[model samples]
Target: MFQFLKRDPVKKLRKAYDAKLEEAMHAQRNGDIRGYAMLTSEAEALWQQIEQLEKK
Candidate 1:
C-alpha cells in the first residue's frame, strides 16, 4: 500500500501555522502591532482548517 507515501494536508497546514505564529512574534517584537494581529488571525484560520481536517 502506498498510503504512507501520500502527503498529509494536516501536517502541511500545521507547519504553515507554526510559521505564521513565528512571523507574528517577530512582527510584535518589531513594534508592528497591525502586522502581528493580521498574522495571528491568519494562523488561527489555519488552525481551524487543521481542526476540520482532523474531524474528518
Candidate 2:
C-alpha cells in the first residue's frame, strides 16, 4: 500500500513559505514593518532554495 508514496522535497519548503508569509502578514497588522519585511524575505529565500532543488 505504501508503494505509491513519493518523496516530496519541496513540500517542507512550501510549508515554510506559507508559515513565513503568515508571520509577515501578522507583523504587518501589528505595524512591525521591519519584522514583516524580514519574514517576507525569508519566505522568498526558502522558495528560491526549493526551486533550486529541482535542478539536482
Candidate 3:
C-alpha cells in the first residue's frame, strides 16, 4: 500500500513549468523552432495554472 504520495498540485505545476521552460530553451538552441514554440506555450500554461492555484 503506497499511501505516502502527497498531492501537491502547485508543486507539480511548478516542476512541469521549470521542465518545459528548460526544454523550450534547449529546443530553440537545437533548431527545433516548432518544438520550442510548443514548449513555451506549455510553460505559459503552467504559469497560468500556478496563478489560478494561488488564487484559490
TM-score of each: 0.96, 0.80, 0.82
Q: Provide the overall lDDT of each model, using Cα atoms, as 2-decimal numbers.
A: 0.99, 0.91, 0.94
> Candidate 3 on 1-56: residue-level lDDT in tens?
66668788999899989999999999999999999999999899889999999999
Better of 1 and 2 by lDDT: 1
Tens digit of per-residue lDDT, candidate 1, span 7-56: 99999999999999999999999999999999999999999999999999
Instruction: Count clashing pairs, candidate 3.
Output: 0
Model 3 regions more than 4 Å off:
1-6
TM-score of 2: 0.80
lDDT of the structure predicted as candidate 3: 0.94
Name the 10 consecutive residues with the lowest summed lDDT in model 3: 1-10
Of 2 and 3, the candidate ahead on TM-score is 3
- What order do you get sorting by lDDT, best first? 1, 3, 2
Give residue 33's lDDT in candidate 1 (0 to 100): 100
RMSD of 1: 0.6
Deviation from native of the Cα of residue 44 in model 1, angstroms: 0.5
